[model samples]
Target chain A: MTEKKKTTIVLFSGDYDKAMAAYIIANGAAAYDHEVTIFHTFWGLNALRKDQQVPVKKGFLEKMFGKMMPRGADKMGISKMNFAGMGPKMIKHVINKHNAMTLPQLIDMAQELEVNLVACTMTMDLLGLQQEELLEKIEYAGVAAYLGEAEDGNVNLFI
Target chain B: MTEKKKTTIVLFSGDYDKAMAAYIIANGAAAYDHEVTIFHTFWGLNALRKDQQVPVKKGFLEKMFGKMMPRGADKMGISKMNFAGMGPKMIKHVINKHNAMTLPQLIDMAQELEVNLVACTMTMDLLGLQQEELLEKIEYAGVAAYLGEAEDGNVNLFI
Candidate 1:
């Protein structure tokens, strides 16, 4: 038997459209029976945040950054045409009309499909995101861990 | 003799930061003797625009889009923290201070280093961009062209 095919995606964008693209690709790859891994770092970490507060501890700057950033995929702004948040609201309306999954729902689907979600520990540290502030049931690792998986993967993507 | 490792980057963002990342990765791969192709599409096509106005005929919507969109790498705004375009200006100042190459300069270096640059034909057709409006010496192709190159590529990224 041949070795299992793998696809690893490094998600580095916090923009709604970009995060949607990454999840769409990840879901598609998983459907094709590929071992999929999504490594979230920096702004991408915002996707893993819970919409409701989790009561985590943070310094002044960290709290400021956390408050300024969108809480979850649902709150993400479009990279362009944001129009002070109207773009995302319009996008959500469109998605609802099309009966398509929201970013948060896609994240759920990815989990149900067993896609490996890896959080970048270094970024979490830098951004002051604690484990309590993020969604549970995800892997926490560094760039080396991602590189090791990427080395032998048949397909590696950085988004 | 060793097989050539191929890397294909699908540049899909118009933001300065994303464009910078794509070119930096392409240059790095080229430095490592890897065959690199940057398939620029949609918003990413902004990076390929010439600084000077090319005076191409366009439809009303296309003309409006052309007028609204930033021209060339130097005019691109940051994906975030744009703050009415001050973010990119600050970034430019920082790059200048570090003596780092600007986006336009990076594009020139990519050309000199022999990195294959392909603009998406469909996007151009949809956006009403003519060949005369863009820089010379780059390939214009469709998704099939990108897929053909990506099929054999060990690393394929959608940025």
Candidate 2:
């Protein structure tokens, strides 16, 4: 039997458009029958955060970070032409107009396609995010785990 | 003889810090005897712009884009905490204090180490950048060329 082709993506940006691109690529790879993994790191973790607030213990800096960052993918802003949150609204409008999926819907589709969604543990700790605050069934790991998957990956992207 | 590992990077950000990360990885891969290529696209093309202004004919929108974007790596802003350009100054200060190489110097070293630097031709046209406005001795190609290099690469990243 042939081994599966691997596609590993390191999602490092928190921007809504960038996250959408990452998920779009991840879902596409999964659809092509590749073993796909999306490792969420740094601000990218915000995409995995639950929409509602979760009660959790944290230090001053962590709490400050939590308060400062968008709670979920829906709250994240676009990377360009943000125009004080207007860009995201406009993008959502376009998505709806074209019958394209939003970032949240893309994430759901990625899950449905059985794409591996991993949160970088070190960054999550630094950002003061706990497991309870993220979506269910996602894996937690570090750079080493990412390197392991990417070293043998057919498509390794740091987005 | 065994083949050398390959690393391909898609640089899509205009931020100084992100560009630095991309160059650092590219330099590291070259040092390790890997075939490395950095394909600069979209806003990332700003990093390749000549610091001096080149008189080039352009349409109204292209001229506006040229006026708005940074002229070169030295003029680019940080991804976060840009505080009216103070952040880049602080970063340059810290880089000096730590005896680290600056972005321009890193690019110079990448060239010295024979790391391939490619500017995406499609984006260059879209952004109104001519070959004369970019650095000398670099390549220009589109997404197909990037995919060709990346499909067999060991470490592929988009930043």
Candidate 3:
């Protein structure tokens, strides 16, 4: 039998819109029967964080980073026209008006579709995020893992 | 002979650092004998704009967009820590100190390396940019061209 096509995405932006785009692509690829993986790195790790505060120990800088970042996908802001956090609201309103899914719903759909959601462990350490602070059932890996998957991928995207 | 690997990038961000990353990866892939193409779209088109102002007809919104966006790669801002344009200066200083190439130099190198630099025609129209306003020797295309290149690509990144 012919090998299945692979689609790997490196989600590097913390912006809500960017994450939504990444998930949308991942979900679409998965629906098309492509082996899809979304590797979350740097600011993108914030998307995997649990929406509620998770009590975790941290050093000064790590604590500061943890505190500064959005708790989860829902709290993340849009990439443009943020207008001090108003842009995300407007986007959500538009999504609702169109009867489309919000970012959280998109993530849920990705999960239901069995999209491989991976968090970059290096960035997680840098951001002071612990396993308990992230959603369950997600994988943790490094850049090497990403490169390994991407090198063989039919479509590899660094988003 | 084995087929040469392909790397295609959809540059969607206008930020200087993002553009630098895209070019760096493109140059690296080209050096490794990969057929690399960078599809500049949306704000990414600003990287291709000529530094000098070109007299082009435009509507009011287009004129405002042209005036607002950076004229070239050198004038683009960083993704973070911009500090009101200070961030780009600091990044330039650091690059010089390390004997690394600046964004403009990198673009020149990409041209010399024969990397395919394609501007998205659709975004150019929306942004009110014309052929005369962009650099010479680059191509203009749309999403179909990008998807055609990316489908067979080993690395297809959206930056």
Best candidate (score: lDDT): 2
**Taking the tens digit of each residue's C-alpha lDDT, what string does model 2 give over B5-116?**
8889999999987898688778877877889999999999999999999998889999899999999999999786454556788667756754677899989999999999
Cα lDDT tens digits, model 2, A1-159, are 999999998887899999999999999999999999999976799999999999998866567668778999999989899778689999999999999999999999999999999998866765578999999989998766776687789888777
Over 4 Å off in model 2, which ranges? B10-77, B81-152
Across A67-106, the per-residue lDDT of candidate 3 in tens digits comes to: 8999999999977655465667766765665466788998
Score each candidate by Cα lDDT.
Answer: 0.84, 0.88, 0.86
Give Cα distance to truth, residue B132, candidate 1, Å.
Answer: 18
Rank list by DockQ: 3, 2, 1
Sort by TM-score, best first. 1, 2, 3
Q: In every candidate, how many clashes are there?
A: 0, 0, 0
Overall local distance difference test of candidate 3: 0.86
In angstroms, give how far residue B52 of model 3 lies from its true place: 6.6
Candidate 1 ranges with C-alpha deviation above 4 Å? B1-6, B15-42, B45-151
